[model samples]
Target: MADSDGEFHADDASDDLEDHRVTTSSKHDTRSRSRPEKAKKGTRKSGKAAWEDIQRSWDAVVEDADGSLTAAIEGRAEAEKRARLLRDTTPLQRGIIRHLVLVVDMSFAMLEKDMLPSRYELTIAYASQFVREYFEQNPISQLAVVGMRDGVAIRISDMSGNPAEHLEKLQGWVKQEPQGNPSLQNALEMCRGALFHTPSHGTREVVIIYGALMSSDPGDIHETITSLVHDRIRVSIVGLAAQVAICDELCTKTNGGDTSSYTIAIDEDHFRSLLLEVTTPPVTRTQEQSNASLLMMGFPSRTLAAGDSIHYCSCHNRPTKEGYKCTRCKSRVCRLPAECPGCGLTLILSTHLARSYHHLFPLRNWVDVPWAEAKRSKACYSCLTAFPEVPRTESGKGKTPEKGKGKNNSGSVPTPLKGLSESGRYACEVCRNHFCIDCDLFAHEVLHNCPGCQSDTRGAQRQNGKATSNGDANGAMEIDS
Candidate 1:
C-alpha cells in the first residue's frame, strides 16, 4: 500500500500473512518437484567418465584363491585383447633423432599403495626400464629426466645419449622419498626451457609419468602449453590416475589433436605398457619442423697412432689413453653418439645410423604358416630351436610325416626340415622359410635382415654369372672365394 506521500511503510499492508509464507502443502509440492531431478543427478554421476582401461592382454585377469580366473572378469580380458589387435601398422616418417625429457611426478599421491610396493617405488622402477627401452628403440636419441615435487622442477640428469648416466641418476634416488604436490606448469616450463635450444632437425619431446589427480600450478598452464606448441615440443602424458581435462587439452593440442598421445594406466603392468609405448619414436609433423633442413653429424672412430701421447677427454676434463677423436674439433671424446664438448658437433658411430635406419624401411610382416606344412618342420632355420610336433587329429593321421623334399624360394634346404615351435610359426614371403614365434619377432623387431635371404647362394651365383668351366682339374676345382 502506498502512503499519501508515496512512502512505503511495513505496518500498512492489506495482504494476508498466510499468502506471503509457504504452507505445509507447498513444502510437500516442492519435495515432489525435486524428486525426479535428484534421481537424474544421481544417475548422471555414475563415475563412468573416471573408468581406466584394463591391460590389453588375455592373461590380464583377476584370479580366485584356486588360481583360476573368475567368470565375472573373463569377458573384460577378452574385450581388451580385441582392442589390442586393432592397432594400426601403417608406415610413417618418425623422428629417430629425438631429444626427450622424462618428467616423473614426485607428489604425495605417489605414496599410495594401490600399485605394488607403492606407486612411487613402482613408478621409479618403471622409469628405469623406460630409460633402457627408450634408448633401445631410439638408439641415437638423447634423454633427460626431470622430477617435480614441492611445486618445483628439478633436473635428475642432463640430456645425454648414454643410458648408463640416466640409470645412475635414477639409482641414486632410491633413498629419496616422494613428497609435496606436483606443479604441472613449473615442470612444463622447465622442460620447455631445457629443450628450447635443441636443434630443429631432431624431435623435442616431453614424457610425463604423472600420478596426481590435481596439479598445484602457480600460474596459467595454458600459457606454458602455448609456449611448448610454438617451440614444437611434443608432450606425452601417462597418468596413474584418471584423465584430467588440462592434461587432455595439453596433449591433444601439442600433438595436433591426436588423442593417442595421452593415456591413463589401470594397474602397474598397464602403466608399464603405457610408458613403454612412448619408447617408439613418434611420427614427425611437417608443420612443426622443416623437412629440407640439413644437419652435419660426425661418425667418431676409435683410432690411435703408435707412440701417440694421451690427451685429456673433452667430455670429462680427465686424462684418457685412447678415445674417439672428434673430426671437427680434434678433441678426444669418451663416448660415441654424443655432442662434442668442444665443437658441439654431433659425434656418433656409423652403426647408430644403421640402427636408426631400420625404422625408416622396416622389414615386412611375415604371414602365419599353415598347420599341415608347419608340423613337418623340425627346427627354426636360424636358431634351430626344436619345434613341438603338431598333435595328430582324430581324422586318422597319427604318425609324424617325413620332411618335405621341396626347397624354399632361397633355393637351399627344404623348409620343412626347419623345426617350427608349438606357439605357431611365421613364414617370410621373400625368403619362403618358416620361423618360430621368437625368431619371427626378432627378425621383424630387431634383426631386420633375414637369415634365409642372406644365406642363399643363388644371389652370389647371379652376381658372378656362373663361372666358365675350365678344362684343367685344378682350375675346375677352384672355389668362388
Candidate 2:
C-alpha cells in the first residue's frame, strides 16, 4: 500500500480504518442478533421499566424553584390553611367516643436512605409522636396499630386508650427488620374486622402511613373500599414516597370520595405535620352518631395494693401493686381512660373531657395587619409585646389612604397574604386588635379564645367611672366574685 520510495499514503490508511470500522459494527450486530426473541423483548421491556423508575425519581426531586415570591406566598398560604383548620369556632357535634386504626406500611421500601437514618426509623419516631398526641387529645378513644408487610397485614397492637402500650410496641420494632411488599387490601380488611365492634355512637377511622408505591393486593380494591364506605369508616393516608393512583383512589373512596383524605409528605417536618393533623378528632358523621345520647361512664377510684398484696387487674389479668377500681362493678383495672371488662362501662376522669372540648368551640383565625395600620400600634393588644418598628420610608411618610383594612375582610376564611404582615402582627377579626405571632398561635391553637374579646376592660372602666360620678363616692367598683 506504500510507495516504493517509503512514502506514507493517505489512501491506504483510510482503507484500513474503514475495514476496522466495518468489523466493529459487525461484531455488535452479531452480539445483538445472538439474543433470543423472548430475551430481546424482555430487555426492551426492562429498559422501559427502568426508564420509568428513573423518571419517577426525577419527578420526586424536581421541585418548583421559580425565582419569585410565589414560594414564600404559598408557604404563608399553607400556614393560613392550618390556622383556618385549627381556628374555626363554629359549634358542631364532635366524636367524643372514637376508635382509630393506624395502618403502617412496613415494606422494604422503608429502608431507603433518602430520609436520614432510613425512612423506617423516622416513621417510627413520627408515629410515636402521633400516638402521644392522639391519646392526649382523645383520652377516651381507643386506637389500634396494624402493620402491612410480606404481602399480609399483622396486628401490632390492640385497640386501647393507653399511649404507653402503643409506645412500647413501637419500641419493640428495633429488633425487627422490614421485608417484602405492603398489602393495602389486607391491611384495610384487618382494620375493618378489628373496628367491627366499635359502637355506633363512636367514630371509626383509619390512618395509613404508606411507604411503597405499589400494593400487593389480590382482590378488587374497589370492593374493599365499597365495604369500608358502607360501614361508615373514614380513611386518611400519609404517603411517605411518590404518589400512587391506587392509594389516592382508596382514600378517596373510603372517605366518601373526598380528596383531602390523602396527602404526601415532602419532607420530615411536613410528615410530622400531616401525621399530627389526624390526631384531632374527626367530625362525627350525622347519620352514624347522635350527639344527644347520654353515655354512662364510671369514675374509678385509684387504690394501692398493700405490702405483700397483689391486686388482680381486669384489663390484663396481671397482678399489679396499684390499680383503678371500677365503682360500678367493683373490679380492679390496670389503667384509667379504659373500658371496664367486668361491666363494659367506660372508666375515665371528668378532666379528660376538656381534651376534646376546644374542638367544639375553636377560636377564630387571626388576620395579618398591614404595615400602615400595624405601624400605628407599638405593642400587641393582648400581651403588650413590643412590635419592631419599620424604618419610615419617604414613601411611607407620604399620606396615603389606608386601604389595607381589606385584610380584615372576614373571620370565617383565611387569606394567604403578606401585605397584612409588614410589621409581623395578627389581628383578631372580632376585636380588630393586633397581636404578635407567638400570642396568635397560642390563642388559636391552645387557648382557643381571644383574650381581648373575653376580658376587655376599657368599656367596663368607662362604666365604672360614670357610676362613681353619679354615686359621689370613691371611684372604686366591686366585681362580683
Candidate 3:
C-alpha cells in the first residue's frame, strides 16, 4: 500500500527508518556522518524492533493445562479481545466496572433437609443470578467459579469475559453429582490456580460462599489467600445461613474484610438484597475501612462448626447471664433449668457436666433412636445420629454421659427383638454369613465401614451350595442331599 497518511511508503522503505530515527533522535542521537551511514544504522535498529514484536506475539498463543497463558500472550490477547469486543459494546470508564461473581458450594453439610431444596440449591440459584446480572450490565467483565463436591476439587468454569460461555460451562459442571466429600481447601486452591497465575489484567477476585462446613486443613490456604489480598485482589465472602469461623479469620488476617450471612428468608426481596449486597463491586478505600470496623463490632458469638447443640443454644431466644452454663452439656445454658437444653437430660449439679451430647449421641443414643425418627433428624445417614457437639470454652471443656445410665437410661431390663429367634438366610456383605436386617446394617456401617455402593462378593459363599447354570442356587442345583 502507498503512504495513505504519509506515515509510510510503497517504495520508500528507507522512509520508515527515517520515521523511527525522528522519534528516537533526541534520546539516542550521536554524531552523524553521511546519509549512507545513517541509513545503515537505521536498518539495524529497525531489524531489532521487528524481532521483539515477533517474539511477543508468539508467546501469546500458547497456554498451560489449567488454562493460564504466558504474560506476553495473556496480556496481548486480553487487550486485543477487549478492544475487539468493545468495538461492538459500551466502554467501561471509572466506577463503570460490573462484577461477575460465581459462588459455589457442594459441601456435604449442605445436604441437610431442614432447608427446603437444600442449601446447595439456594447457593446455586443466587450465584447464577449474580452472574446473569453482571453480564447484563457490563458484558466484558470476567467471571469464574470453583467449588467442592465429594471431597474432590471442582473447577466450575474457567475465568472468562464471555458470560454466555461461562454460564453454560457452570451449568454443565453443576449437573454432575458431588464427587466424594466437601473440602473447602481444595476449592480455594483450584480458584488460586485459575485466577492469579494467568496474565489477567485489571482487578481479579474469588468470593467464597460457604458455611460451617470446611476442610481439615484451612491453614494450608494461608499462603494463597495472603498473596491474593496483598495484591489487592478482592475476596468478598457470603456466609449463607451459616459459615466457617475460619472464614472470618482468613478474611480478617489478610484484608480485614467483612462477611454477610442471610437468615432463612421468607420473602423474595430479602433474597435479592442479600444477593446484590455480596456481589456488589468493590467499595472505595474509606468504605472498606468502615466495613472492617463493622466486621469487628458485630462479631458472631456462636462458634462455627462448634457442633449442632452449642450452635443451637447460642442462637436460642432466651439469653441468660453470660456465665450461667449447664453442667452436664457444658453448653452454656441458663441456671433456671436442671435439664440441659441440648441433650434433654437432667442436670448433674456439678460445675461442669460430665458428658457432651455429641459423644453421647453417637456412642449411646445413635442406634437407640428409632429409625423412623432418626430419618427425620439431620443425622449422618451412615451413622444415623447427629455428629458430636463441641463446647465453646477455650479450655477444651466437653462432657460425656454418666457411666451407668448412658443411653436407654431406664433401670428396667429389656428383652431382645423377637424376630431374631427364627433362623433366616441373609448374606453379610463382608463375612457372607446369614443375618437379619438389624445386624446387616450394623456390620456394614460399624464393623465393615463399607458404604454399600458396590457388589457384595461374599453372597456366593452365603448360599452354602454350588451355583446353578441359571445362577439361581435355589433350584436345579446340587443341594447338600
- Tell me the spans in candidate 2 whose CA falls farther than 4 Å from its real position: 1-91, 301-312, 317-323, 370-384, 389-420, 430-434, 452-481
**What are the lDDT scores of the predictions, listed in order?**
0.75, 0.77, 0.44
> Model 2 over residues 1-481: C-alpha lDDT tens digits?
6789989999989999999999999998998899855544424555554344544422322123343445355546545644544445567778867899998888999999777788888888888989988887778899999998899998999998988999999889855789999999999999999899888888999999998889899999889999998888899999988889988887878776589889999988788889998977777656648547777777766799888898789898997999888887788888888888989988887667655677777777777776667666788988898875543434555653343222222211122343335556778887788888778766766676788786654444345346323222244342221
Q: What TM-score does candidate 1 reach?
A: 0.72
Quality of model 3 by C-alpha lDDT: 0.44
- Supply every candidate's count of residue pairs whose N, Cα or C atoms clash at under 3 angstroms: 4, 1, 15
Task: Give the alpha carbon lDDT tens digit for every residue of 129-247 in model 1.
Answer: 99988887788899999999998998999889999999999999867899999999999998988897788778999999988999998888888889888888889999988889999
Q: Give, for candidate 1, the lowest lDDT window spanning 10 residues.
A: 409-418
Q: Please state every model's RMSD to the true fold in angstroms.
A: 15.6, 13.3, 30.5
After superposing candidate 3 on the true structure, give the runs of residues whose Cα lies further than 4 Å from its correct spot: 1-101, 173-175, 197-201, 257-272, 284-481
Which residue window of length 10 is worst by lDDT in model 2?
A: 404-413
All candidates in order of TM-score, best leading = 1, 2, 3
Candidate No. with top lDDT: 2
Looking at candidate 2, what is the lDDT of residue 73? Answer: 55
Which whole-number lDDT from 0 to 100 does residue 415 have in model 3? 23
lDDT of the structure predicted as candidate 2: 0.77
Winner by lDDT between candidate 3 and candidate 1:
1
